[model samples]
Target: MTLVNTMEYNKDDLLDKVQEDAENLFRSGTYFCSEAVLQTINELLGKPYDENIVKLASGFPIGMGKAQCLCGAVSGGQMGLGIVYGRVEGEPMKDKMFDVSKKLHDYIIDEYKSTCCRVITRKWQGDDFKSPERKEHCITITGMVARWVANELIEDNKIQVGR
Candidate 1:
């Protein structure tokens, strides 16, 4: 645990919060998979960009508007990585941005066999997208992706745990 503002901040707690918030946000319909992940990470990072920065990830849900190409959660994870490692004017670019992005892709692919939304959700093909099982699966992925990014941030020292 690290002390922040005189309070003990536990890294494990932060990771749990990231996962819970991301899952709840999606379950509450406040945001889709991508938006939830984006929103959760942005807040975790202290809102570095504008409040509406999550808009950048809006179109990524449902595998790019139901096209079912890339996993929406993965897309959101990539955006989260960019928010931390993105290139800025007059600032040196972060090489870890590319490295982490690819790592996320590879991680998802390794776990799901493909990063495509349709592929990840293949077990729900005949079921309604809004079905509880399908929703739970997506919600689980959203939470996992958010936690993964938070863990990476902690490991990279980009975020001070117990902040």
Candidate 2:
């Protein structure tokens, strides 16, 4: 698996499906951070859940409705992990879920020092929420979080890139 550490990922359909695709959705102004993450992963997984699944991620945007605690992208990515690694109620817990979930959190913390939405976007708090700079910053993180999750799925052999 070509992990993201190499900064090398296939520029194939997987890129379109995960990172760039989600970025576009967020840039379109309809989908927010968490929604874009869930939407892109849903598409990549062949829509295991229906369109309404996106609502699960809606509350996470702007750090749980602008509470600015957790990073919405990270929260959304965790939901993506749940979709992949979570088991049925009667089944045993998947061991990999905790590990992967923490890894996702680590990814954000390692890069930005904290996964809190306020911390990550601290520089842009004074700007208008719809300002291009603010939007671009969130958009970039949205793409990065999606790409990181996609890379994890690929490395763990959970999902194929193109599929």
Candidate 3:
């Protein structure tokens, strides 16, 4: 059965469903920061969970020591924006994608006050991954980021209609 039929959901109920889905995804092995954000966006947009997106996000893990230039949450938001507003070669909307990315970046930074992993996890810099406090903080912040993205996309009418 389709997700809509199984859940008996209308557009108005999407946010709660998305939040629940995001929490579930987080509890699952897909705890990578970016996956949480992507899952939330997919659920909000009524898109089926895509493995490719998860796989792409798996590459980003602050605790894993990747220490990639971009924050995982920001990367996830950009990915979501790409899915929603990106374009192929010579396709229109390239500029729109950049604009949307900027918006997502601004939103993330505004919420967290800083996008740097080091800044966000100053309490456990070298071993934050090993501490329960730090782990919980990561989970909480990631969830907050996911919820913020969902709220923004929904408010801005960026989510596709009739998914």
Candidate 4:
């Protein structure tokens, strides 16, 4: 129900808007960046994967459960890529899945200069983890990650784009 330049948005636009909203809502809770992205992407993809899969992303936040390793956003984006192109047991789509994952990881690293949550957080909001500013920073990043996945879906013709 958003309007840009006084023009009503289509279904695709609405989907994007809701995903962004969901990201913020989820982040306000104990959910981390990876969980936020996974949940949002699941809904945006029309729930292609089971909602229960969000649990799989739980341990990825704060760099694999506060380990300060890989960025949770990057991990979630890779999961999203897998959700779209991954194969079930005995399937053979690893190469394709890896390719899309690499694209997402490269994009995030290139844009943010690293794939660690600590580095990303420091670069964006310093070391304050409890301030409203920090919350906003994470929310913005979550939205950006969701949008990037949506764009990739559109580019691959996996989803329709709004005109």
TM-scores of the candidates are 0.90, 0.88, 0.75, 0.80
Clashing pairs in 3: none
Top candidate when judged by lDDT against the true structure: 1
Candidate 4 segments whose C-alpha is farther than 4 A from its true place? 1-19, 123-128
Candidate 1 segments exceeding 4 Å error = 1-7, 89-92
Winner on TM-score between 1 and 2 is 1
Query: Please, what are the lDDT tens digits per residue for candidate 1 over residues 6-103?
Result: 12457888888789989999999999999999888888887777769889999999899888999899999999999989887998878888899999
Tens-digit lDDT track of model 3 for 3-97: 34323544446655555566556656566677777756664565645555567677666733466346676666666666667677987666767
Residue 17, model 3, lDDT? 57
lDDT of 2 by residue, 1-163 (tens): 1122222335355654478888988999768999988888776766789888989999998899989889888988999888999898899998899999999999899999999998999998866466798889999999999988877887887765432
Question: Which window of ten consecutive residues has the lowest lDDT sum in model 1?
Answer: 1-10
Runs of candidate 3 exceeding 4 Å displacement: 1-13, 63-65, 160-163
How does residue 24 of candidate 2 score in lDDT? 89
Candidate 2 TM-score over all chains jointly: 0.88
User: Which structure is stronger by TM-score: 3 or 4?
Assistant: 4
Native-referenced Cα lDDT, model 2: 0.82
